[model samples]
Target: MGRVLSVNAREFEEWMQRSLAACEAALDGFVPIDAPVGLGVAMRYAVLDGGKRLRPLLVLATCEAVDGDREAAMRAACAVELIHAYSLVHDDMPCMDDDVLRRGKPTVHVQFGEAQAMLAGDAMQALAFDVLTPDSGVAPALQARLCALLARSAGHAGMAGGQAIDLASVGLSLDEATLRDMHRRKTGVLLQASVMMGAACAETPARATAALAEYGAALGLAFQVVDDILDVTQDSEVLGKTAGKDQDANKPTYVSLMGLEPARALAQELRCQAQQALADSGLPNTAWLSMLADMVVERDN
Candidate 1:
């Protein structure tokens, strides 16, 4: 087994930059520009190039941690990103959050009309599965597994269900447990799926898989906690989205339930749990996962 090696921030940053570039190229190549006029353009606009690409990065990182197939991991990374982009498109519509900004630019609904934006989201979701269940490359069994993973994570029991709870909880005071549950479904499940999907692409041991799942859960929760903190502390320019919108909308968040300092502490605690889980995993090389846990907490955006 390859032993875990300590990687400095600069080294990891360079690796991440390169991985992101490869992921971007794959996305560009996978998401086609068809002749549907506005719909095709809107789909491209929604998915082509934007956002932090955190889900894809998680997929790639977890795959690397497990010594998974690089090609499968790359496809998994791009597939998860497509689902995320679709979610953002629908989430920013006038019927939902009604936001005008995303990834430091106009949301799809704002750039394209609401109708085209909806269609774009719908098409991108279909394309996500298409990218996963390709005619060749990945095995059919793995394709089925990946499809199931992506669907469950993005569907009602995961992101969609969480979003529903979020809409229902606006202006209502929620306790910490309820808030965490909501975030787990809304944000955490998909992140967890990213890690799990990566492991599925490889021959990871059951014990190590369980440990990675735990790490993904902790890291996902930490990610949301940090996002809650950033919403309170950062500006629109820095955050790429409208800052303080959660507060303005009276959405119950980590910072809203606990103070900023406590919320920050909660994020750190989760990060530590993630690192501990990685350490528990018998997989020799967990350095990437550990570094990613830190990045989840330290990220400003």
Candidate 2:
């Protein structure tokens, strides 16, 4: 527990640098020369930009817990990040959050035009698969499974569906149940995939996959809970994105529905549920997993 919070920022920086470097190297070799190269640059712009890399890190960590091959895990890790990056690119569009800042820099739509941001997201969606099924070299069945997991997480069953629900809820009175469904789709699905994909790399049993899925769901909701808490307490500089945007936009959130203290309590409970799910999976060596759960509950950003 002490070591998790004490993770050196320098080590995290180095790890991210290595991950981004490899992702770029793979893209550089495979991207078609006929394409204007601008697309690749935009892709780089979105991906190379700063982030916690939490989702991909989860993928890698879960894979290790399952005793899977690390190299194969990289492909899924990269895929999840691309999907995450693409979602952020679109999420910051003028039509969506319309924020001008992210990771302490201009949002993609602010730096590039909205059209470019949309295009970049489109390209990333395709490129994510380029990383997964082909580059990873999992068995055909596993590749199919990975692709399915990603599709559900990124598409209607996951992020897309969540965003749709959220957008619809704007300016409307929503209850706690409504908010939970919105988050479950928008954030929960991808997170569930992060753990599932890692297990997929190791060909984990159905039971383990189910357990990890539960962990991801609980963690995903917990992530939203923290985000809600941060919106009220944290500043833009610390958050690296617009804060209080939900309140400003009149969007429904846990803090708005449950109040500050209860929201925090719920987040803590969700984190514990997530941690317990992993423990019940019967996997070993959960140091990083515990760290991740702690970070989700305690993160300022």
lDDT of 1 by residue, 1-301 (tens): 2334688889888988999999999998988788387677888888877888889988898888888888888999999999999999999998999999999999998898899899999999999998998788899989988999999999999999999999999999999899999999999999999999999989899999999899999999999999999999999999999999999999999998989999999998998788878878888777777888888899998
The candidate that wins on TM-score is 1
lDDT of 2 by residue, 93-210 (tens): 9898888888889988888788878988898889888777674356777778788889988988789999988888888878889889898898888987888888888868777778
Top model by lDDT, which number? Answer: 1
Residues forming the 10-long window of minimal summed lDDT in candidate 1: 1-10
In model 1, how large is the Cα lDDT of residue 252?
A: 96
Question: Which residue pairs overlap in candidate 2's backbone?
Answer: none
| TM of each candidate vs. truth | 0.97, 0.89
- Taken over the whole model, the C-alpha lDDT of each candidate is 0.90, 0.80
